[model samples]
Target chain A: MKGITVRSPARAAELFHALADPTRLEILDELKEGECCVCELTDRLQAGQSRLSFHLKVLKGAGMIVDRREGRWMYYSVNAEALAELDDLVDSLKQAKRARRATGCC
Target chain B: MKGITVRSPARAAELFHALADPTRLEILDELKEGECCVCELTDRLQAGQSRLSFHLKVLKGAGMIVDRREGRWMYYSVNAEALAELDDLVDSLKQAKRARRATGCC
Candidate 1:
């Protein structure tokens, strides 16, 4: 809850669900290089504007990315803070798994 | 590819999709304790046998768990190897995302 130590199965499911689409994953890939407007992303991804926007909304809603308006274009970038917390969660999971193994729980 | 450095959007999507459901996440949580049979899990989770089996199938198909037959009961445990790779993938993503930010790509 505080930093990647996910105790709620529902929350874990929601977070993972946000990353469960190919198109959305591709959008994240594009954003990996930097922030970009929807137009540039649409052009680079060669995806329809509407579909791209939908995926963007999913990622944004999940707190994976953030958007800023600059004149006519809205630029989107990965929410580094949010993503860092996700990374921390993964680390905690790994540790938990190891602890389980050590205790011969499974 | 070799470890958790995921290069394919499609593969990442597939892996994440396998973990997107609350039931599946619950199953993973149950397995975190150790190997369990369908009956034990169903009793603990208060879910129906058919639905639990379906979730188990999904987890197994994703290489996240393995099943074994022991006389009359079938047992399952987390595929620690696969899960470890997934953890590694998360680590790599964190590094990649950080690298992108440092270079002011976004």
Candidate 2:
């Protein structure tokens, strides 16, 4: 389960850090099913407008979520391919961990 | 080339933080080819013993790299499965980015 986790350590680290915060993770979850406007996200998320915006900004910065402006409203979507890749990557880690000798060093 | 990247934003952020530091990134790069002992890593890395240990600890904490202690010496190897998963995830991102509409945001 260790070592053989993610390819491109830098890339992995970048991706990991992008979702480091709970708020950001929450935003991704909200968008998992489909795109939603800011109002919809706030109503469903039940968070302050400013706080939600901040989280959205972070997610967007990381390229984990994309938003489009249709007039004053912004619609957000789950980057489905990204999510699929993530599961597969983790699955790969699970497989590698089985073959690898689990080291004690942590 | 934006708003479509790594899956499991949380996982991605974790992996990103693991390699966030230059030292950690360098350590990862060194391990890219194969595993190495602390001494070998130190000699090749030309970094302080304490610093190297700290970096190794961070990488280990994030499951980016693994080490096996054969006596007092520890051999570290890149988790191949993890590496493959990381690339595939990125490729997935590339695909999503290409298909998704580019949106302008702060």
Candidate 3:
């Protein structure tokens, strides 16, 4: 089994922190359907434009999501690499559990 | 592809919030070796007892780690179930990314 390694605890924490919000999770869910413009997300999420923008910024800052400006609209989609990294982080915890169980250390 | 379903955004956020701390991640790393008593964790992480306790509490509260009382000591270990759940959450995002790319939604 591959060992779980968090080379940068700060970076992992930042990624998790970006995921620690209901609004942001909703945004991610919305974006998961496909690239969405700001107006579409605001309507779908029923979030105020400013509030939605803040969550988008947080997700983008964490590299969890990517955005592109198309003329007047900004489109957003989930970043697959970041999600894979987060998956690896969770796998690390699972690996630790396996190691502890195997060693049965007390 | 299995769709990503966030049944409860609040609960997901709570779990992610528990993991959004560098100290807590460090603690998880230590426990990955095996079950650890409070004193051992304090020494290994170089964290004061109170601070450590706070992080432990958060992890425990979110079901990220489990504790057992053994006479005068409390041992901690990672919760495999919670980690699995977190992994699934991350997978959901990945699935979404795939869906978006497959459809090429704009």
Candidate 4:
């Protein structure tokens, strides 16, 4: 919600829907720095493991996060490929903002 | 999936989940040029009205798209704020890529 504008209005709603939840957004903001173990995430998020697990799983299933097992702990990180797609997603917002200058959309 | 990378791994999953569908992604891609009517989308996507409407509704609910009604036709565009957030999302991916260079995640 910083620099990019809406380029693809149709998909904007659905895109934001994934981020509309406070818990999910918070979880994502937390992961901005780097990968964290479930325990650390739980402490940082102040969320129960059950909830954290669910959120983490959602992120993972979306191909947003990937994990590596270290002994009994699992470490997770973001998917670069998906991230790039997101960049394009945000670019649509930028285009939409510019669309205001052009009224030729069909 | 171009320039941006994942910034928030956890959120990445949630974000991508919002866009994982071919329909949703296609819708977003189509709108990238500018606002388009359901008719145009329907034509471009070669999908039925019911399905297009359903997909459009989903994108709107997700905050990816905003609509303006012109007589009977509905015109939709993307939201820039959400796109910026997406840029940040992709940044996490760039970081993750860099993180690969440094193995000090806690």
The number of the candidate with the highest TM-score is: 3
Positional deviation of residue A67's Cα in model 2 after best superposition, in angstroms: 2.5
Docking category of candidate 1:
acceptable
Q: Write the per-residue lDDT of candidate 3 for residues B1-106, one digit (tens) a residue.
A: 5666787899999999998999999998888867888888888888999999999999999999999988888989888888788877887666634444443323
Candidate 2, TM-score vs. the true structure?
A: 0.58
> What TM-scores do the predictions have?
0.83, 0.58, 0.89, 0.58
Give candidate 3 misplaced runs (Cα > 4 Å).
A1-3, A96-106, B96-106
Candidate 4 wrongly placed segments (more than 4 Å): A1-24, A79-82, A88-106, B1-20, B80-82, B88-106
* Ten-residue region with minimum lDDT total, candidate 4 chain A: A92-101
In the order shown, the chain A TM-scores of the predictions are 0.81, 0.72, 0.87, 0.69
What is the C-alpha DockQ of each candidate?
0.38, 0.13, 0.55, 0.16
For residues A31-97, what per-residue lDDT tens digits would candidate 2 score against the true structure? 6545677887788768899999888887776567788888888988766655665565444343432
**Ten residues in sequence with the least summed lDDT for candidate 1 chain B:** B97-106
| Error of model 1, residue A47, in angstroms | 0.8
Q: State the lDDT of candidate 1 residue by residue for B1-106, as single tens digits.
A: 2323357767777777888888887787777666788998888888999999999998888788899998778989888877776776555455454323333222
Task: Determine the iRMS, in angstroms, of model 4.
Answer: 7.6
Which residue segments of model 1 deviate by more than 4 Å? A1-5, A95-106, B1-5, B96-106
